[model samples]
Target: MTNQQLLTKPIGIDVNQVADSSSEEATKAESSKPELNSDEGLPLLLKAIIEGFVDGVLILTTNQEWFHANECGRRMCSQISQGKLPINSIPEPIWRVCQSLIDSREWFSDRKRFLEDEIKVNKSVEFRVRVRWLTLDLSRDPYLLVTLEDQHQSTKNSAITDVINYGLSQREQEVWLLKKANFTYEEIAHQLYISINTVKKHLKKIYAKQKQLMQH
Candidate 1:
C-alpha cells in the first residue's frame, strides 16, 4: 500500500514512511549521497534507523521469535534477563506484555493495537515496555514492534544533553544532575563534598546558562 493509504488507517505512524522521510531529508542535506536499491536497501535503512534510537527496538514475529533487535535492545534484553537467557531470547517480563497484546489482537480483533506496561526491577530501575502491531503487508500476519525504555537512563540522557546544549561547566553539570534527581541543596553539597553555599552557587550559574541558551 502507498504511504497515503497506510496513513489513512489508525495504526499509528508508519515505520516505512518514517524511514523514507528520513532518507529524503538526509539526501537533501547531502546531495552527493549514493542511491539505495529500493527492495534490499529499505530494510537495511529501517534497521539503521532503529539502531540509532536511544530506546531499545525489537521487531518480533507473533510467536515471539526475534526478527530484528538493535544493540540497545540486546543490552536491555540482557539486563531484563539478568544475563541468564540466550542472547536472542526475549526476557519473560517483556514477552509477557507482548503476549498480552497478541491475545488482545486475537480476542478483540482490531479494538486494540497498542499496549504499554512498566516493569520495575527495583526502586531505581524500570523499563517502559510498549508493544504495537506492525503491518508491513496486508496479506501477511502483522509483527510486533516492542520498545524497551530504561526510565532512569532516559532521564539521565536528557539531562546530559541539556547540560551540553546549555554549555554547563563541569562542576555545574554535576550539581545540575543532582538537582534534577530531586536532591536537596544540602544533599547535593554533601554528595559533591562542598558547602551548601557552593551548591547554590553552581545551581545559580547553571540556571543562568540554561536561560541564556533558551533566549537565543
Candidate 2:
C-alpha cells in the first residue's frame, strides 16, 4: 500500500477515547469506595477502564497470580491455553517476562517502568505484550497490567498483504507494513536502514502501483 493509504486506513480502536473514558470511570469508582484502596478495590476500578481497550488485558498481583482478565484476554487465553483456566493460561514466554518484572526491585522503585516484547503464538499468529506498573490507589499497593495485541490483526486490512499479492518488491512490502503500523517516515527509514529520501522514493512507487491497481 502507499504510505498515504496506509496512514489513512482506519485501525478500529481509538486509544485516546478509551483512556479518557477509563480514567473517568475509575474516578467515579474511587469516589464510591474512598477507603477501599486494596487490590480488591483496584480491580473494580481497572475493570471499568480496561474493558474499553481493544487489547487483551490481565491484571496481575504482586505474586504473579491473575487478579482479572478482560473478555478479550479470556478469549486469547482460551486459544493459547488449550482449556486451561484463564488464571493459569499465561504462555510460558510471557509468563517468564512477567516473573522477571515481578522479581525486579526496579519495577517497584520506578513508578513508570514499562516492559514490552513480541511473542509468536504459532507460525501465523504473533502478539505484542506490554507490561506496565500501575498504582491505582495511593492507599493500596501497585499492580502489573499486562496488555496483548495481535500484531497481524492490526495489519489485516492494510495493504501489506495486498503489496505481497500484487508482486511488489520485498523492500516495498516491508515499507508498507511499517507504514501500516503507524511508523513515521523517519522511523521507517531508520528501521529499514535507508535514507529518508529513499523511503519517500519507495512510497512514490508504491502509490503509483496502488493507483494503477485501482484503475483496473
TM-score on alpha carbons, each prediction: 0.66, 0.53
- CA RMSD for every model? 9.2, 12.9
Q: Which stretches of candidate 2 lie over 4 Å from their true place?
A: 1-46, 84-88, 106-108, 160-216
Task: Write model 2 residue lDDT over 68-171, tens digit each, in one string.
Answer: 77888877766665555545466666676666666655535444355677776674467777776655443256667788887777675556567765667989
What are the runs in model 1 whose C-alpha is more than 4 Å off? 1-42, 106-108, 122-125, 182-187, 208-216
Taking the tens digit of each residue's C-alpha lDDT, what string does model 1 give over 48-161?
788899899997888778877889999988888878998799898888888877776566676345777887776567888888777653226777888999988877888899
Q: What is the lDDT of candidate 2?
A: 0.66
> lDDT values of the candidates?
0.75, 0.66
What is the alpha-carbon lDDT of model 1 when measured against the actual structure?
0.75
- Shift of residue 104 alpha carbon in model 2, Å: 3.3
